[model samples]
Target: MSGLPERIERGFAAARQIADAVLLEGYVLYPYRASAAKNRLRWQFGVLVPPEYTAQGGEHSHQRTECLMEARDGDRLAVELRFLRVQRRTVEQATAAGFESVERLELADRDLVEWDEGVEERIELLVPVEELAGEGVQRPFRLPGVGETGLVHERDAVVGRVIRRREQVDGLLWLRAEELPGPYRAQRLTVEVENSSAWRPSRHATRDQALPRSLVSAHLLLGLEHGRFLSVTDPPEWARPAVERCRNERTWPVLAGPEGERGVVLSSPIILEDHPRIAPESLGTLYDATEIDEILALRTAALTEEEKREARGTDDRAGAVIDLAESMPPEVLDRLHGAIRGLREATGSTALGRPEQPWWDPGDDPGVDPERDRVLVDGHQVGAGSRVLLRPGRRRTDAQDLFLDGRTGIVEAVLHDLDGSVHLAVTVEDDPGADLWRAQGRFRYFQPDEVTPLDGTAPVEGTAALDGAAPVEGP
Candidate 1:
């Protein structure tokens, strides 16, 4: 941001916040230790493998993101490329002669294990909108190679040493723009990122060997000083055709910042909706494993002291997670459990016979208790105590409904959707999961047209042997 134009850096505070999360999506996984098997496999997304090695067949050597924009004269486009560069950390123990590279160097305080660490890197360039209009711009860039060594000491003697090595990763960026025929002056912007690194590997080299030359978790953030970018995922009706014509390869572009703000675009490998925001309830990133912060924090807290110590030594980010988990207060951990993003005027029974109500908001829908609500189905009154024979035939029904076609279930509730259709939630009598689903306030929803009214709420005695077939369909 230091070199970027002031306006380009203005509203990007929120955009960068989200992009940073994307960069660390898979940096590390559970049990965050160098020895952890899953930790060996990192950088799961947006990996542009070296071209020569990619010819052997694996992830592609490039990614392309195309989006639509509305810009005027004098508008400048700011492009910021961010990615993780793999830094190989090797531990070496001090020998009588000199230092020797060892898999692990054990110290009194902690263990130092050889691991691949991700170092954040960014490239910023501001190009005028005019430059990207006609033939556009194409340029080649390189992430300069680096190698460094740090001495490890204890008391007076230097017991061991650590080596960090990184190979150069070369890449190319191509930006092209075309004026589209539309109601307004619109342009299609295409950005292509390719990994053209010349590093070649030996026969049958593992992916780990290729990391030093590869682009890990690559993504781009585009800012418009005066113009606005359209939402690629949810374009307006007039711009749908143009948005569809844009071909995005491997990566997608989404509107960034608050909802409806189109000044910025976050092109990433992960699929997300427009205006994607990190939940305020989230304490911090857990590196995209399950994304259940509570569960990950709990598991992190449960790690043995020895394991925790190794995790802390694996990487700075891992150490931060370890410290966060250990120091998180109980109330803060509870905040991670649940959150209500927002609420609206909710209605009753998302699917009853009358005007449908929202099932999510509990207290809004008055006089519509599932236990007391009754609806007429096939000229028969059916409520929470009524029984029915399922005959599911809806075109959108799940395949499992075929098994429930003839099964008998007791109606648990009568629900209604916004449409004029009615749905009866029922629990199958013989289902092993019936109790579990019922306790969770879930039931199999059957429309009035999908079920036949059956007599009595109690299970027919001595007739459980009829299998799922309706037993003596009584009036």
Candidate 2:
């Protein structure tokens, strides 16, 4: 086993927001209540079942995560194992003799029913990288069962009670690292999580019956102290072969945190980009990450008083979503309609495409011809059908521009934005999908200074523009 690190929670906190969204995704569907059919199969992703259940033909019992990390001396690794524990809530009607379990219990203020809820659990395995590199780490852990009761009282007399219980679950975690033979000192790290629960159900047990001994929404968040983790999704050329041999099972690792930061890796059940983020306009989780906030909130707002009452009695989180929809100010809720971000360059010189005219009238922007318009690049006129060399500026370029450093391309159009700035749209000459890109009007954008004319040709006059061209993809 490897040595443990002193600081544990620092790395986990940095990547907590997106991690939480992943944890609660699909927790409950729209119209959150037991009556909704989608609420029955709630825990959908990253479910690790007990080995005994798999022996009788069920879901898989284990998952493995493998990723690459660049490290040096004084580097430490912390593995955060996070999952949800199944909890069964049963409403029992208080009787003169003893409490008898009932399908539904009605109280003065609310109603109650039997439902499944998840309790979050996280086990941290903090180890020094030096010791991990020397030998592997093995740790045994358990997700203890819970039992409790909450009394429902009306006018000082107990009417009913809710009993919550769950079966005990056990598991084992394994970690190891192997050094890659390359100029860059990189380590191939492997972490495996297995469900070793001894509990088993009857031969014909249903999925809900087998879920008590399973790990729901299981995932691993790995953090580094003084090292950097490579983007497995978009690794460099030299590390592609090693990355191909990583052998990640049931989950994919992505570079997490704010844009250029690479100290954390979130190995999730769903595939995601380098840095997945929640939209700024979102208020909070409504349990369905796949749906837009405006639509979900509107649906919640449209529910009847009886529906809202049932939803409020469903769960605490569901009630909170209901409150957000019903209590939000008009200005705050309007923000959910839309938001525009990352405007590259502004467009100028379009009398018809003005701030007052609507393009549907067929009189807007008659002079705006994307293909016929000409822009000055390095003091040379370049437009459609002209060849130019791509010279993406160093400090002004994004990570994607690194690949287009010295590539030559043909000008597809000269686009203008509503912000009163001009941009040039071009297609790479060597790209096999260049024709398809032009046909679809999806061209890469760049500033006038980023390109140089390759051929000496006169500027194009307004014959006609690229027919039905969309806006530039990006700059």
Candidate 3:
């Protein structure tokens, strides 16, 4: 655990954190449902659909992305591209007999007709074109189509074709550029990735469905040598200025805009991370933690009762699936618990009652009393010098950097804001170099809701706890 594996594990953890942030960028829950009034804007990042195609319904089009690449003379490089393919399909609902009348039928009186829903088809091809060679003479290379096999379900069917191969396809696209043409210089390269799919009318179909489109969460992964990975979710320091400017203006100059403008405005960051080496070998692999997580999450959610039982009983991947199913969000867990309770009630098996400690229970202490502007630890008040834990489930942000979720810290001061909001200034125990007392100290102010007081035998330090005999207030 203390060697290359450890480093790789840490890298994956960091990558996962960045991916999680990107995963929640547009929507909060699973299924990535689109709401016109909510998720109104699509193609937030890495949008490549041409304006003409977009104007013509954008059902079928090619999307490409350009990035800056650097390599020494004659150095080989590998590039991996990862993105999500979102498909839309029509679902038909059945009504009970005589329920499709002037008046709406009651829940008990109406029965929904069940029909098989076909899976939407989306095809993606990522090609690293020669635009990176700096206007040099072209050398053509042809590659044969790759064939793959998988379960073909007519119901909810999804088919992917690459270079006209009809088969199930992996989501990742890779391209390798061998024998670099230049030495240790920055070069701009373009990756031409295309999505192709068509919607066909069906007997129960209400409207013509659009072809499947790609949704990039801006979580591209670049795998460099020596187990190092560059996460494109957050741009590197050098690219931050440009990314920030684009983010501030809510537009980007990459994809064509609605009015046929050369660039599309962005509402989020266009992250980029470059490798330190010059023209390293392109691994030609795609690594996306969030995409993997999403697949597992959806699979777990779609499991039937019998399948779930089998999963719980089986070993290998089936058992792992059960574990993933149990790892849903707190809100989802609560809903599941309510559903289980309802099922138990319907079966008249109240003998088990409710478990002594339900899975969704958050335990006794509620952390903060907003009205009192004070911290409570298991029903006890917290004072200066008392150790405490930051509340979990907070959205990771700049202001929350000083305190990590579940990390314990020492309370340096407790103060009130102008609006009567309580703010706790704490110095993280692990961060000994933190300047807790200064105005610009490493100590950060947190809302009472952000921290939970921990039990301590020592008495409160009182006014002496103040960094300079004056209490720091306000953000």
Candidate 4:
């Protein structure tokens, strides 16, 4: 609601200059943290240059450029060219600025300590964008919903808030917005169409009305006070007329539905909002309540004994060990087995068995389905598969290494990644080479024509039942 600040304008100017020369380049200016005091304030910055900047015959050859600016109280302005590390202040000078605590210089794990331990501390900086970019920067840093010029627009249309974002079970992102407040909520609704495969939110609105690119305007919608609205709300002052016009005329194309089978039909007159130039980080916090609530609901659900064991990354049960043994390499398997043995020894258990199973019970089938790679133990489906792997030891580059393996089955699941991939319980027949099937995360992206849908192919009944009171089995 407030106007853009002068500092932001200046920052944008500096950012533009840096981006001009190093298009697609990235830079960071971190502030220094105080060592001894909880509320210590220090100024320090770290510059990051992309590898492209140092490629042969590249424009810039510097590596990890750092600058220390003078802590001028009244006039806060600084700029530097490509080559130099702008020296803001020395250790002695920093002391004069009230940095006297020697313990402040202490680091956590001193593995790779670098220079400037005296004044070097990682801090978040609020610097001018242009200064952050260095001089002559042109390209904009595209983050989250920001655009090429750090401005957000839809179909060249500008509205107020993001009212609704419908992320379908099939990986589709649909957004609906009403114009800024003016009229009743019902009359203000306008749809904004964005095709995932075709459109990027960063595309700028052009003057050329005939171009298909221009068809995707940056329409605006007003966010309610709490930030989220599933249906619709009144338009803000700037959007009253536009929202009314859109509603009455049924202008924008929204709600993409099936046309026949291959193509999709979208209702027209997509509504949108331009991102504010300068706003508080919490301005749009209310809009994410729905997503946050959904997440909480998922977290609150109870896990079965097997589910809890797998969740804890433990191999106390035969089912879980089976899952691990099927997926892990020999060395990793040995390490895991040793860990389990150590745990059993420490707990005074003679054998490694299901954590929840009785000491005399080893035949307790946890209901692990190795053929389908789904583990239903103790009446609950233990785990499922995911698209992107985010395990602690399994980074993206680790490929399919991010999997929940058990004697009965192995399910690939995501730990932290946010790709369109899902966590599903899939069945594999005798053919381990058969196309991997996933079922759990609502999406069913079957490999093209690999398996036809049949009545029995749906998830087996009782798949959702809680796993409870099953006899534990030993590994």
Candidate 5:
């Protein structure tokens, strides 16, 4: 394999070429939207690269990104290349856009809903509306009305201009409404139902039935600081009555709080016959009093450093950096951190679409590979190392790198095939430690003698391959 300097040299060469063909081409900046909290307003600086520079994706061929405005109105601001895709636009249009086309990108500051936290803990739940029969209300359809907040249900409710008739032959009518232009043109009006069929006629008794209970529903817009809790239901059927009643009144069932209420307006108002609504039996009405405290207790429980790391979006690098930082002397730590930051910036300059990895130069070593002798996995022999074949990175479907730890004989076999290719079958032992380094995949082949000496000694030539193709795909 080529040495570190060679790999980095090639990577930088490619990045420069891409920069010349794309980044220097320039782009245009346009105002988008501002955050409700007024912390930032989004803007887009569109850059049109030549047809040759477009990434291989559909409409995504053109990249789109959001940037924070430095001032209410300013021409100059830091930008990052966010959306990098190819769009079919004339070169003249692109050149006319008066914005620096170099490094036109920015990082997103939004936190997505924690859907990946766990299946048991949902970020949001929908308590769909349903119809319930009432006195003299044979065709009673609930209308929440546009721009109302919270759920509201009245047993014998009457709403004029109910555009949607309930599909149920004998079930209660369900009507949904969205914001529309009013007669005055400036006011918002309630239009027809969104999807009337989504509401079903359900009874309170069965497990899947929508219970018969008066309810007030609210569609909450949650912000970062606030949270609401929905306790696990002992008997899920308790939710039915609330859902049914919400349908009668046209309110969305919701868990609300001060935090979730931040900078967010409810889609509709919740109006039950009574000012304060009663909890349904399905929600374990009694537990409602204690559920909040229990949730608070869970939140207050002590957590390990690892758990805290997860909360901050730290992965393997975080632990490594922390562990390494803690061991360094105070003065050395500062220097090392600064150096690390610089390294990160330099490496980031050669990322995807950038010319970090350059075209192959025939004059370079072109490297050499030793014939594989024996292959073993978990102690049992698989085949001769020469019999294994591997196609490392650069190719679309090829494996990148391979790593093997000393313990547990993680890599038992390294095989070479008749076609002069190689493969390594690994067998990992007991569960690995959080700080453990498992076997790494290998792209280029090297002699064992060439690698053993370089492990801890002074860095040698071709050490870049030992570091697993850094500049090619640096962190």
Candidate 6:
């Protein structure tokens, strides 16, 4: 992939991160029981509810996500949607004999065994696409399946059925918008994929026990022939309300948006990449070959040993992933390191090849010591009174009005949260002159990673007094 442009490569990497986030969003470890506390938060991202939600007395907030794109007249866009499905197994356990029949008395609790039942009937949906005009006139088209498993069949312009197999529980749907038909201009086009399915409630279950009808881990890969890729992290004006509404409800929304528009603009974790479609010259053993292996290693490391066994038993793919992680020889590690070195040399960023290790508490008293713990601002240590620039990106929360990217601010204080996360309180450098003591609200709290220290401003040894006023109680 060195043949690809650097911007395209960055976009691809960002997209991959987003996709990985989506894949593991609601993924619970093996022994996937409904009663598990960790499993309660399933289907949080890209949830498309079926029409049956109306009958079930629940509102379907959204059924599809739309992205605005600019394409040249002759460009073809490729869309890919990948997601996993829930599979269940039922096993019978012998009931303990207390005062039951004499024949039942012979069997003890240790004698009981559980056997794997055949797979359950997989749910099907129709993932149809529509190209909307400027006036919102939708021209529906069936998104046909590309592969040989025959999972998707286009019946008409309005419907495309997705038939997933029991063995192949997950799905990957591919659709391409070929050459535009009949005087259709490609500039400022609207593309929407509907996860159309009817909700089917579980038999012999109460209303409260019903699960979400539709769930999809969708990542749109838009390949433009002649046009440049803009952004997957920004949402259109029309979709902002929906995004905000979902955020207010404390749920992860699909809209990625306008960062400075009132509160923090949240983006969808959905991954997207736009790349040239031409086949690359084959390098016998490129770094890209080990991408999946690396991902598997990371995922396997996250699981406990018991969970690993359960994963191996239920999922062949998971088993294979674990095996790959285990079977990697020292030579492979050396090659991977060499690949990283090459990448760093090409990119001119020393940060590219650094290995990221998970944060662990080595001993007791892991809490942050406000005086001793120095805040890292874009890899450099900075303290109170230090001038810094806000890093560009959407923040989880925009409490202190640090929404503007590359905005400069002056550090007022370093505060530590109850959870041991350190935050820097900064007052915007351009803010209207106000009494620092009285206008503490103007000072925003930001994580150290969100800002970069500016030069010539040495870190102050002690916290600066707000305009020589008395110290405030909290951030």
Best by lDDT: 1
lDDT of 6 by residue, 252-298 (tens): 22322122211111123333232211112211111121133334454
**Model 5 per-residue lDDT tens digits across residues 1-475:** 1222332223323332222212211121101011122212111122212122222211011211111111111111111111122111111111244322221112132111111110000012111111111221123223231221111123443211111111111113222212112332111111111112133333333211211111111122211112112211111254333223222123222222222221111222322121122222111111111133223222323334433343222112223333342344445423322222233334343545564643443235233222223322222222222222222234333233333323222333344445644444433335354124333542334322212221132333444345321111110
Question: In order, what lDDT does every prediction score?
Answer: 0.82, 0.81, 0.36, 0.24, 0.23, 0.39
Go through the candidates in order and give the clash count of each: 11, 5, 17, 80, 67, 2
Question: How do the predictions measure up, each by TM-score?
Answer: 0.77, 0.72, 0.30, 0.18, 0.16, 0.38
Q: In terms of TM-score, how similar is model 2 to the real structure?
A: 0.72
lDDT of 3 by residue, 46-160 (tens): 4332223444453323433333344334333333233333322222222343112111111221211111111222222222334234442222222222333222123364221
Candidate 1 lDDT, 412-474, residue by residue in tens? 877765564667889998989988999999888887667777974433445433332221221
Pick the TM-score winner: 1
Error of 5 at 14 (Å): 49
lDDT of 2 at 223: 84
- For 115-196, candidate 2 gives per-residue lDDT tens digits of 8878888878777787776558988898678899999888999988999998899998889899999689999999999999
Q: Write the per-residue lDDT of candidate 4 for residues 1-475, one digit (tens) a residue.
A: 1233354333334333222212111111001111213212211111222222223212221111111111212322222111111111111112335333221122121111111111111111123322222232222211122111111123563211111111111001122222234333322222222212222222343212111111111111112111122211233454444533443221222211111110111121223122112121111111111122222222222334433333222111222323332344445423322222233343353355634435443235343332233233334333333121112232334334334222122334212113422233334334354353433332221211112212223333664343321211221
TM-score of 1: 0.77
Clashes of 4: 80
Poorest lDDT segment (10 consecutive residues) of candidate 6: 103-112
Candidate structures ordered by lDDT, highest first: 1, 2, 6, 3, 4, 5
TM-score of candidate 3 to 2 decimals:
0.30
Candidate 6: lDDT over CA atoms?
0.39
TM-score order of candidates, best first? 1, 2, 6, 3, 4, 5
Better of 1 and 6 by lDDT: 1
Predicted structure 5: lDDT = 0.23
